[model samples]
Target chain A: MAKKFLQRLGLKDKLLAIIVPLLVLAAWQGAVSQKLCSELILTPPLTLLNTLLELAQSGDLTLNILASLKRVMIGFLLGGTSGFVIGILMALSPFLNRIFGPLIKALQQVPEFAWMPLIIMFLGIDEFAKYFFVAIGAFYPMVLNTYQGVSGVPEKYHELARVFDYKSFRYLFKVIIPSALPSIITGIRLSLGLSWMFVVGAELFGSDSGVGYLMTWGRAVFQIDLVMAGLILVGVIGFAMNFLLERAEKQFLLWREPVDGRPA
Target chain B: MSNNKGTLEIRNLSKSFIVDNSPLQILNNINLTVTSGSFVSIVGSSGCGKTTLLRIILGLENHYDGEALMDGKQIVGPGTNRGIVFQDHRLLPWLTVGENVAFGLDKLNRKEKKLLVDEHLQLVGLIGFESVYPSQLSGGMAQRVAIARALANKPEMLLLDEPLGALDALTRMYMQKELERLWQLEKITMIMVTHDIEEAIYLSDKVVIMSSRPGIIKQIIDVSSSRPRDRASSEFMQIKAEILEEFHLGTEYTFAYAI
Candidate 1:
């Protein structure tokens, strides 16, 4: 009965989802008022909100966000496209899979940050280094997921394709790709999250204007409120990106009926 | 509708598979001839290799010895000349009913493909369900779509591997009538593999029975009764009894029917 009620939630019940967070915030504010910790160490939510507003007024927040967004887009496109292509190639050809499969697995094992020092030395502390780092982060998940998606297509579908005597390109696009789309979309979603995470890591070392840089600057100047504001902004932007991608996924996968027999 | 277009001749057909190391024979010394536009049903219990025989004729399995000839040519592999519907509807989940039918008409231009898809959809009496995806369809409806898909290619022979097996009893009976209508209208040769004895008797021009343990054809009974055969008719019961007797299931089946 509780599950049924939850499933049939109205607007009033939907609003209840926010109650826990609001209560947590109230407790946090109360603790700050009672001087539970030093002000510099723990900034209240109100002070962080004020800092956010001030940054917004100064236009530095928008500039930094745009700079970070630009880097993310460039890196995601470069990494996603190449990963998608290579993944498909690997899935289609046993020879290519054998040649590069081990190498990809090895690269996946090494931490993304471990390559940072060498990448900085090779490409210097410029946009290229940051972009390269983010690309590497995004690339691995995309490759792994796409490879799995393509390689694991049901043999029945392949038999259907054979029955139709579908041409190679037609089979790949119409049968293979559409069939593997759910997995590929999952990979893309993971890649996007990884890209966002790598942006902070990429900006942490030798970066002047990004959300990560903003946080670093706040830390350097002992401004806890500014750091909290930066953290909030990153969280909000990541949530927004994820929300948009989820909407896209829903649109693309409209034909897929839910396994539990819920409405598509 | 030219009835002379789809003649099938199978001669000295045999198939076996290597299970572990020893060759376990699945089909043995099978021979059958199906005239153009005839409805032939191969009925046997499970493990009788009826489906395997259908697959061999459909050119899905090639390791078998002997000949499967469509018209005058030897069957090589799955081609447009022969269309098939499996026990499962097997419609791609991503495709709508219309799109699934159109999947067979890959060679046609878009306009022609649309026309053919519509025609076949209407042929299967699914005119308004063009946009509905496969997942939303009931078992009987999905099988109808499968039939539409098979007919979209305008193959000389339509192969059915228990196409209506998944449907409920009521739907199965309804679909059997629909299958009869389709056969009459299309005038294409149909080779169906089924285990249901009554189903074999109801629609088939000829019913071929096979025995298991190195599956081999035991007998082929001719159903020369008129169209719209009555299930309770003596003629139908006689043929059903004969087929059951071959499987040593005659007394038991009759007792079950009496109950």
Candidate 2:
């Protein structure tokens, strides 16, 4: 009975999600204006907004965002495509799987951050080093998801491939790839998210440009409002990317029937 | 539309598997021949290895002991000469009906592929459903798409592994008529694996009934009844009775063979 009541009491309108955040913001602003919290620790809401607009007006925000986006996009593209292909190969070939599967798995167990010192030592604190690090971040999830998708394809489709006498290339490209697309899409989404985090981390650690660098500079100067603005932009952009990918999935996967009016 | 091809002969075709480190025989000493442009149904109770037999004929199960020959050639692996409609239809969910039909025709030009797809869809009576997805279709409709996909390849032999088994009774009866019509119109050999005896009687030139526990043909009964067969006729009932007796389930007697 309590569970039923909770179910019914759940957000009746999705717009209701904005309420608590708005309330918290209003309280935060009220406290900050009255000096109940120090400006050094928590920048006032109005000051934060001013800093955001000023950054936009001066085009610094745009430059920083573009720099960050370039790194993320390149890293994601390089990592995602290779991950997809290599994952499929791993699933298809027993010899390749035996050779590299366990080695990769063992490497993944070592913290990714652990690779940073070795990478910086060899490549130096340059753009290539950052790109390489971010690419590594994008690689793991994409490979895992693509491997699962290809390996776990229903046996019936394999039978169909046999009946058609599809050559290996045709079998992989036409049947295996398409059948595993939904899973690959999942990998791409996850890998994109990882790439975003990785680019930000790379910039924070070394780069003299990008949103992460801007936040680092703001901290060096004690400009808390600029740091807050950068955080807001990151959250909003990440949300937008996720939303667009979801919409694309719905469009391409229209053949799948939904359950309870939600896309399956 | 008759041609001098799609003749299949199974000679001493026996199969076994290493189940739990023991050689568990699945099929034993099976022998059958299906002529070109004929409709044959293999009927038996569950565990009869009828599906395995079809897979062997389809050249998917290649570890069998003896030869499964088609048109005087040894059936080795799956070829474009044979197309199969699996029990669940098995249409690729991401593909539309038209794309699914066009899937196997890699050698053809785009225009030829489109024409063949349209023609096969028409033959299966699903011509306007080209843009539709399998999930948007009914079970019977999906099975029709499967048939259309198989026919699109223009194979000499079409294998159906209980293609209509998932449909409701009314739809099954309707599809029985549809299958008969399709077989007659296409003039190709069709080998269907079914457990439905009356379905076997209604559509097949020959009904090969097998016994379980080492699936072997118990009888190959010929039905020479004319086209558009009557299910309610005494002849149909008698054939149903004969099949039920072979399975030792003869008492029930009620069948539109849609059961």
Residues A1-264 of candidate 2: C-alpha lDDT, one tens digit per residue: 755664587854454568667888889999988889988899877788889899999999899999999999998888887888889989888898888799879988988788899999999889888888888888988988999899988898998888887778888888998888889889998999989888888888877889899889888898888788888888888888889989998887777765644221
lDDT of 1 by residue, B1-259 (tens): 4757888998998999999999999999999999999999999889999999998888888888988888978988998989999998889989988999999888889999999999999999999999998888888999999999999999999999998898899999999999999999999999999988889889999999999989999999999999999988877888888888998877856745833
Q: Model 1, residue B125: displacement in angstroms?
A: 1.1
TM-score on alpha carbons, each prediction:
0.94, 0.94
Which CAPRI quality tier does the interface of model 1 achieve? acceptable
Which pairs of residues clash in candidate 1, taking residues 3 or more apart in a chain or in different chains? none
TM-score of the A chain in candidate 2: the value is 0.92
Q: What are the runs in model 2 whose C-alpha is more than 4 Å off?
A: A1-12, A260-264, B251-259
For DockQ, the strongest prediction is: 2
DockQ versus reference, model 1:
0.47
Interface RMSD of 1: 3.2
Model 2 scores what on Cα lDDT?
A: 0.88
Candidate 1, residue B235: the lDDT equals: 76
